[model samples]
Target: EGAVFIPASLAYLIGTNIFGPLAYKMGRSFSSGVVNAWNELSIPLAKKFEHLLAPNAGWGFAIGMVDSAMMPIMGHLVDLRHVSVYGSVYAIADVAFCLGFAIGSPAISGSIIQAIGFKWLMWVTAIVNMLYSPLMILLRNPSKKEEKEVSFNINIKILLTQSKIKE
Candidate 1:
């Protein structure tokens, strides 16, 4: 455990320092997706070796890297929204994070491990993460101008519909 723990923590610090700045250069969505996908894909690959120091260390590093990148990307996503909705955005994010990470992941992973074992768990997780990665990479955060235009169009449509009803 110590072998894994020490390397993971050290790599986490390195990944945090590296990816935080890279997010600005590469765009948050793309950076986060690639990092996350790599992290997930690395697991099964590393697990294939089983009980080796090097592969496990690398797997731990990948885990640390993804975990480090996620928080900042989440914050960047919230920042894309309106200041008025900041509280709501953060509240929703916190709830999802808590539900998914704090509660759901552990419970689900534990069941998977019990049903099969660690080896299969890694593969299952990798498959799921790969399926989710495209969406994360492709999702666009609309610009402020686009948001205003959309809002205006909706308002106009509502007004027009109301006028037709009154007629």
Candidate 2:
């Protein structure tokens, strides 16, 4: 069970290296969409070749690629829109991420697994993942609204006043 995620971790490292530059060239949303498309496609292929290690590895790789690429896009968007309160934005995002992945996903997946079993769940999730790619590709970066620029200028003067401390 734990061993299965090794391929995903490796793929994440590789995807980070590859997509960092690609994001700069192609735009973050588009790059993310491409990686997600890879992820969406990998599941069916893995289902088809369920007996092979390679297809499962590919599925892991694709998942890693999507995660690696999509994770930063949220931060980028937050920075663009909420530069003043980016810290708060990040905190909220972190909580949401933890809740979704750690709690919601497992709970939902357990129910889904019980209801339909694992094989159909993969297919269903793959279709859902496929649906998101088009939205990512079509996403237009929002134009940053002009805000009153805050200037950082500090003038500090320390004056030591000698006072009688001892009487």
Candidate 3:
């Protein structure tokens, strides 16, 4: 457990740190596909670690990597769907995503997991998200200039600084 725990935590930290910034340049759906695809590797991992009583370092790490990357990707995904929002109207978009994440994730996950075991659930999730990603790329949604790109760095910068910078 100790071996698995440390490696998994480290992997999650690395994934979120690395992918959070990378997700900026890669765009939302693309980066999400990259992360979500990590679950497919778990099939091989499940085989590799089948003898172990608990999650081995590799299995834990792989799941950690995907799970960690998924966190920040959620924000990017919200922005993907709400790219053009700005000013007072941005609050609406923010609330919508927050509500969906806070309320919707549990609702969807419970039903899905009840029908499928954990391992198969991950595989299904991985395949479904990966399959749709290229379609999202092909069917680009047109929007205003705000939709084109967002500097997440600016948000980080604001948080670090004591004073807020006016945009």
Candidate 4:
């Protein structure tokens, strides 16, 4: 319990202190991509070193990090995409998560893990999570507004030069 608590506490603190602001600057889509990318890269090594870290605490701590980080970042995405209705969107999402937690059980997860095999289950989860990284492409980059201003200025300059040449 101590091991799980310590790691989980650390993860939450770091997520709140470090990742939260980073996410705000990077935008929800990019931050989520970075998080997933880092996880996909780190997970295999972490599994190999599982015993060294703590035998049974891995699942608890990892789940804690996921729970801490995923929810708010997703809320941020809803904020970006639907500025006016983000509150409603987040409320529905929160309710859905609560229902999932209420209905989901260790036995169900255990059965699925057994059927899929733990490694396979992990790999499949990684792949599915990785699928989200590409979804960042669909998101309008947060910097696009600044980029548009710069590009617009450049375009005007080019048009002026072209007109002068035509004269």
State which candidate has the highest TM-score. Answer: 2
What stretches of model 1 exceed 4 Å from their correct place? Answer: 27-81, 140-167
- What tens-digit string does per-residue lDDT give for candidate 4 at 81-131? 544456776677788877777665454657877798755665666677677
lDDT of 2 at 159: 21
Model 2 steric clash total: 0
| Residue pairs whose backbone atoms clash in candidate 2 | none
Lowest-scoring 10 consecutive residues by lDDT in candidate 3?
A: 49-58
RMSD of every prediction: 6.0, 8.6, 12.3, 9.1
Candidate 1 lDDT trough over 10 residues, lowest sum:
47-56
**On a 0 to 100 scale, what is the lDDT of residue 80 in model 2?**
69
Off by over 4 Å in 2: 27-52, 70-72, 138-140, 146-167
Per-model TM values vs. the true structure: 0.61, 0.63, 0.45, 0.53
Report the candidate with higher TM-score, 1 versus 4. 1
Error of model 4, residue 157, in angstroms: 38
Best by lDDT: 1
**Candidate models: Cα lDDT each:** 0.60, 0.58, 0.54, 0.55
**Could you tell me the C-alpha RMSD of candidate 1 in Å?**
6.0
Residues 1-167 of candidate 2 have per-residue lDDT tens digits of 55655665676677667766566456554544444445545544553333334444555555545555554666667766766556666677678867989886778889988999766776666666667766765435665645544221111111222223332
Question: In candidate 1, which residue pairs get closer than 3 Å at backbone N, Cα or C atoms, i.e. clash?
Answer: none
Candidate 1: deviation at residue 98, Å?
A: 3.3
- Name every residue pair that clashes in candidate 3: none
